[model samples]
Target: MITMKEIARRANVSSATVSRVLNNSGYVSDDVRKRIMKIIEETGYIPSEHAKALRTKQSNVIGVILPKLSTETSSRLVNGISEELAKHGYQILLANTNLDPEKEIENLKLLKSKQVDGIILLATNRGQELVSEIQKLSIPFVATGQVIEGVPSVINNNFQAAKDITSHLIEKGHQKIAFIGVDEADWEVGHRRKEGYLAALKENQLRIVDEWIQKGIFSIESGYTSMKKILESGNERPTAVVCVTDRLAIGAMEYLGEIGLSIPNDIALTGMGASDLSKYVVPRLTTIDLLSETTGAEAAKTLLEIIKEGNTSDKKVIDYRLIIRDSI
Candidate 1:
């Protein structure tokens, strides 16, 4: 295997300088960086992770713990985290907890045991306890997509975003607005979005009807099933429906299409998540952009700053927006 020593010799720089460039630690002059890159490319040099860890007391690895990676929402967040970490010569160790508290805690221990320098968590309610545990370990970690008390977080304003989307429907002459989200007992995202929905209606002097609110998993199948249940009940079909996530919105749309319901004419549909898939669907989804990419990037940056500054007392909050489309 091509080694850093050979690259250093070829680049006419010290091995330490070559190592610094490769590891993204310490400073290398522009000339030295260019020469090292050239030598690395020509020699196909690859640094040994073990050796780098010995030098920096860092594994060059970050743990990314998400509820699940099966959905596009988590996938996009991971993409953003990976992109930022790569720029800093860091590798991501992904852990899918399947929204299980035990699994998430287990993964946290494993990542710490492996000596990862930092972690980014897309957390649920159970995260508050896990984060409290992680804090005691003095490990650098950031929560993305959801917030927990007493920990730094990178979150979109889910409450405000949902409120804005709901208010828009109300302004468009829709008196009865339905909300579909996951069980609030599990995910914080669902809870906050639901809060926003209720807040908007309450502020507008509209009755908050329990019959109009639905909860299930944040999946297309769940959305479809829940929406079907709502339709079957014959309990005042809502003029508009707001979903907690884009996947749910898409699923609800599919059901609406099957039942010969015209979107925005018979019933309007909208959801959270600015995922690309939302654009391709017919009567393209009207949704909110969570700025998930920025959230991920900022999480990495904040974690790195915490690691460098040796401080964990700060938190970061990102904003969200409503992206109107043909759906509403």
Candidate 2:
């Protein structure tokens, strides 16, 4: 392993000069800086990141927390985050929470202990415990997919997206619509979406039946069960169904198929997230595109800015679009 001294000796410069050149500090002349850089590059002299952190108080590493790694949404968000962070010479230390809130809190502390420059959270919930933990952290962080008061975040207009999709269904002459949602603990996907669906129905003067609403976890099996219940319990079946996520919608579709019901002909359907599976499924699910990758990229950029320039308590809202497909 070549040391800075060796590189200095090879370049006929003092160790301090080489340090200045490597750190880009204390301004060495351009010609000398270039010579030292060339020698260091040619000799493959790698600087100690630990020493660098000790000197500059920056690890150049960012911690990322995701709800799950298997989902297409999470994967796309990670891709966006990785691309943005790499441009700044920062790497991600990933922590998977597996949809557990306690693990989310634990991972935050663990990442802080590792002295990462900052954290980016793909949050599923905004519980007080998580909010309190976030407030206590010294490092800056930005949340994606959900909003937390007093915390910077990058989020979609989930309420508007839901309302738009519901209104779209209404425009297609769907007066009797059903909803498949998740636990309200997930404010963005569950509560806000339900609120939007209700708002659209009320605005359009459509009657909402209590039996038309069903709750499911973020899973295909849960969606299937919820749909089954809705179909069995309701006296008057809904003509269309709007699901909070593509996964849920897919499950509902499977149940409909098992019952020999044709889509749009018998029942129309819509889903959110625009997951990759949405386009490939038979009839190609009509859904909302939350611009998830853009949301992740923006969250990373926001966190980096906060880490570099101090937190501005900024909140960014990304836009969404509806993808019309054969399902609806």
The numbered model that scores best in TM-score is 2
Which pairs clash in the backbone of model 1?
Answer: none
Candidate 2 runs further than 4 Å off:
none
Candidate 1 C-alpha lDDT tens digits along 185-295? 654577888998999999999877676788878778988887787787675788899999888988999899999999989999998888787899999999998887888
The weakest ten consecutive residues by lDDT in model 1 span 125-134
Total backbone clashes of model 1? 0
Per-candidate clashes come to 0, 0
- Per-prediction TM-score: 0.85, 0.97
Q: How well does candidate 1 match the true structure, expressed as C-alpha RMSD?
A: 3.7
Instruction: Write candidate 2's Cα lDDT for 106-224 as tens digits.
Output: 99999999999999999999999999999999888999989998899999999999999999999999999999999999999999999999999999999988888999999999879
Worst 10 residues of 2 by lDDT: 307-316
